[model samples]
Target chain A: MVAQSTGADAKNPIQVIERMMKLLDVLSYYHDPVSLKQLALETGLHPSTAHRILAAMGATGFVERGEPGSYQLGIRLLELGNLVKSRINIRDSALPLMQRLHQEIGESVNLGVRQGDEIVYVERTSSGRSSVRVVHLVGARAPLHVTAVGKLFLLEDGLPALREYAKRTGLPGLTPNSLTSLPALSRELDKVRRHGVAFDNEEIEQGLRCIAAPIRDDSGDLVAGLSVSAPAERHSANWAPLVKQTADDISAAIGYVKPDQPAARR
Target chain B: MVAQSTGADAKNPIQVIERMMKLLDVLSYYHDPVSLKQLALETGLHPSTAHRILAAMGATGFVERGEPGSYQLGIRLLELGNLVKSRINIRDSALPLMQRLHQEIGESVNLGVRQGDEIVYVERTSSGRSSVRVVHLVGARAPLHVTAVGKLFLLEDGLPALREYAKRTGLPGLTPNSLTSLPALSRELDKVRRHGVAFDNEEIEQGLRCIAAPIRDDSGDLVAGLSVSAPAERHSANWAPLVKQTADDISAAIGYVKPDQPAARR
Candidate 1:
């Protein structure tokens, strides 16, 4: 039915809805309050159009007016986000093991899941004594080709899907070491498949490194990634086995059984 | 400008937005998927009106169609939630100290802030070894009078505001020990003001108990609450001094200085 409505329909409700979504997408990119003019410019909508949509959204608590004409994503979204996070039981199940890993390694440990072309950090244990802050904050995101957790998901996607992803995102680079070529990223994913680990060596941010292992669900499908992140100077390949073991432990708790290893480590 | 519209007009974009918000509000109340028929019935909108709004929302990824006819809140909300959660710098400043408190007390530690009539848990450190589950998950919300952190907010609201709150919420009781009477609640707030700590003695849950201390900002405004939670049997009043110290430590980290304490602890 929606497909049937074509041509110049300025008063179309669907077009208004589309414009509303574009405004929200723009707001999601900003951490601070944004003015109506900025939002209008970013979305390519007229100032009056943006203002009307924003006012409607404000009434619904999806957008909040701040200093005069500036607006922000509302608390209602936080309420909804909490509901979504709570529904995903993997976060609760993996957090204990993530804590244990943080205690042992004295480095930041993160749990992330794939959301489209990005990876979202759903849970994390911070490196307490480090003066330098770890960049993999909970709820933080990075492109699939740049983050260790992201590569685990990319490895699950075959060469064709990965190539398509590269084309779609243009392989945006975050640091000097980020893989900007299809061949380079493909080779990295190959290692991830064989070694059961992925690395972000000063990739997403300078001086930071991450080692990630895949988390499996009851059906032995990759569900999430558990990554141990540290400064590049302190990162070691020695942590791979321990990280893999912890990921395996979380997978087991979620009813995943290794097809090859009859007696998996608990 | 929105106040100019009074009577219903079919072509009015604001009325359509109101219907859209009504659908979302209904969806928020459910943890499981809801059918279109049920949503229409709950919102008192025609099925066609609800369907049109839901389809628009689904396009924007705010709602997801599940199990053919059922719908659930989408991951886009989760993405936006992460954005909002990460933007709040207090969660970052309080976390390391909360981790320290959790280590010292061997219980779950939480950070919460007031949002309208409820308190939202912004950050928490799980008690790793405990079998008992902590109910205050990140992004979770509860009524102002029901949580230990919430009571600290009430203590700041003064007598008149507290009375208005009681009348507004009807002092809804969750357990036998809940403060359902206005006088009883006032007395509890009085104690909280004097002692600088608030206790939830099985107020929200039967076996769970929480003790909370107020977190202040640079302007000396009460900004958030820091709480330690444990089972009723394991809870101790001795943790009060330690909790207060940690709350004060976090306050100091955020540039808050008490007028009485000239030397703030680093």
Candidate 2:
């Protein structure tokens, strides 16, 4: 399908679908109701051709008439979009990239999300070295404060939320090194917020450490976290930038747009 | 445009758009790769015509050629769907239903969503009566445990989350009847979870009480809450069902489907 862009934009395209799509493109570009003349001008379609196509699309609720000779994108697009959003599996988009990252770092690359106060691991790719533990736990849940990815969520929730989380969970300790007090956790969260990455230093278990970065949605909401986990002897803070980069790669794979960057459009 | 549906299916449709959409519908309907014969049969188009159109659409990434003659829906729909999802405003769909609910209940109907620890009012329609105290707070943020709509979000977050919320906010008191402890909030949330509705009995402000129901999106995720706020003296528990119904109506407007019900399609 990708090879026919030239044909699609030629005077004739898909017999009629491309013309209809061109009209839709115009409708999507304009936030306000667009006049027939304006739409035809934008798409290089004859007014009669554009009108006929718009009327045909309007029948299917793909385009909506606003006032006389004017139209807007229709509600049907929203319905289809909602269906697509529901169907999109983040794990599907992240899997190949997770495999790539696992190969790059030679460690377990994992993806996890919050379920209540626990971060549930949804996907993982291992180093195959098998020296470090923690494998085959696809549906495992861990406390939010004890894992590197969990801390990204805590930072996302902000300081007051961290204080509340500590107060409520009593900052239960999984290890002696786990920061179980409000101040300590708050300080850790500060670094996570500053660096846009987090770490679990023998926190969840002995001799295991991890570094994680947040994965966001197109809405800029934190949807998941990507982490590189390894044995304490093998891990380093130097992996921070690479972990963050892979997380960003997964974020882009799953349609997240950084606020500083302009969103790409079709 | 709708009246032309009959013509669309008779033999030819829109010069080619409908037939292409028919192919798309079949592709979308099938979860796996569809053979050329199957699509041609499904859409009543000749194999050559189907192949030609599929080739054209394949060039545009709207359809992907799979093994040999097999085809599947492509990634372009996801990109377009994401665009549509971002552009959709809940306020646009909710306002009309909120107005209808306001007209029925003679009270202020409001829409809200959680923003961190606060429930921000996004859209609303007030009864013609002048008894309500809160209005015109489109971007205002209030503590999640205080507003009627806020309770729905708390309920959505579940009990342990509710416990954390109580511990975090200390169930801050804004009025004499405001819930100020975990036990009271737990009991309140139970009723909300059971009845699928929540209330604010002069909790945010004296003399202003509210009844609320959760509004979910396509994935059954509670995206917002719909509420009717009125003077405490005039409020009634009997309004719960109507409020819930209106919330469901708005949920449907924004493409939320009930888990037990089959989704409607084009």
Candidate 3:
């Protein structure tokens, strides 16, 4: 489903649902419990409106009141989420491939798919090194302009959709190296499409460098992207071929046939 | 927030929301993709009504349409679920302790909390052995009358609530050892309350056994339960005390301070 806010059309029932969805969005952003006042400020809703919305959500177990006045997403949402994740066959299918990539690169491996204006991580595997900490959780989202997986999906969607997406979500810089203009990003996507790979040169995070490739379904539609991320010092130009080959292997395993290859080759 | 349905009684907007919640209840039962016809049959609604409800849910990104008109909970739900799981401090607080128990006992450890009539697993750690394929994922639910963790939560909520829960959800036999009558289950809960531990001797699954303890908050009210499950062949009489001690240790680690300590210790 598309994640967009309904406009201020009073005749739309979806508008009411949009307001409710906004409340959830505000709650989801906080790492700790949030108070009603803070929620009102964040959502630009009046205190009473936010309070009533939160109460309705809490009653249905969509949001929970924790530690007296603070609120967080409730357990019911988690149950629903678990059901969703289980139904997505990609998670189980890609896990072994992700593990192998992690072993080969000695870095964090991620699998992500485009959802609306952002890329959502579907699975991640990290090398067992005490010094490294993986920042991307299974359900975390990143902007399309700033991440390797995002660029991979953008390139796979082709030029027209990529131009539209860049127009809509404007390529804001997350780091100094991140492409902040649509023209620059368009040129980058063209390069990615030619090479069948994308790179994040300390764009999403200051010290992190990532190389990614697109994963396609049996229909040749871009279904997801796979990447290996490590500190920039460790990820030299030599790692690009390895990451692209691993991604192709994963794509083949998931029933994606190359353009001229026979089905029997799989 | 509670997980139980309040049923259909269209009194006001809240009741209308309750009707909508019934649709969610039907979706929550199956992890696999379900058809609109199946949802209509399960919820006792007309096909047209089910179609509209599913469409609304799908549009809102709460449910996703899978292959050939089948429906499943969407990734948006998982994003929300990850938010809820992150705020659940008890899961992180109990993980190291659960890991220790799993290592000591060579069993699968589970951490769960009561969500209305069911226990939803918040965290799980497997033995990671090739021989065992215990496939309980995080966020899976179990009935309150069957599993050891479920029984622990029931007992922690006190005997009166336990009786009411059993009366409402009827203790049907899941396996030969499941307690099928109110009186028998009430007696079992009483013993668990007195001794601070609960056991599942093939009550949920025929060849599995589990031991669980309640985790209490600062107010001494039970917030969750921790348990370990193993094959019934591993449950000799000699292992009872070891299981009980492990449960007690986890309970203590999660802030279940004993009341009857000596004055010097206090």
In order, the B-chain TM-scores come to: 0.65, 0.75, 0.60
CA lDDT of each prediction against the hidden true structure: 0.82, 0.77, 0.72
Query: Candidate 3: TM-score?
Result: 0.39
- Candidate achieving higher lDDT, 1 or 3: 1
Which number leads on TM-score?
2
* Root-mean-square deviation of candidate 2: 8.1
Angstrom error at residue B103, model 1? 38
lDDT of 2: 0.77
Candidate 1: Cα lDDT at A195? 95
Q: Which ten residues in a row have the lowest lDDT in candidate 3 chain B?
A: B257-266
The ten-residue window of minimal lDDT in model 3 chain A covers A1-10
Native-contact recovery for every candidate? 0.45, 0.23, 0.43
What would you estimate as the lDDT of candidate 3?
0.72
What's the ranking of the predictions by TM-score, best on top?
2, 1, 3
lDDT of 3 by residue, A147-207 (tens): 9889987776777887788778777788999998878888988888888889888899899
Positional deviation of residue B192's Cα in model 2 after best superposition, in angstroms: 18
Q: In model 1, what is the error at residue A149, expressed in angstroms?
A: 12
- Which regions of candidate 1 fall more than 4 Å away from where they truly are? A1-13, A90-266, B1-13, B91-266
Question: Residues B1-266, candidate 3, lDDT per residue (tens digit)?
Answer: 33233354323334334445566766766666788888777766767766766666666677778675688666567656655654567876678777877777667778888898988899988657525746347999889889888888777677788778877887778898999888888888887877667888898888888777777642356788777777787665454566567556655433343555311110
Each candidate's DockQ: 0.17, 0.21, 0.16
lDDT over C-alpha atoms for residue B256 of model 1 = 59
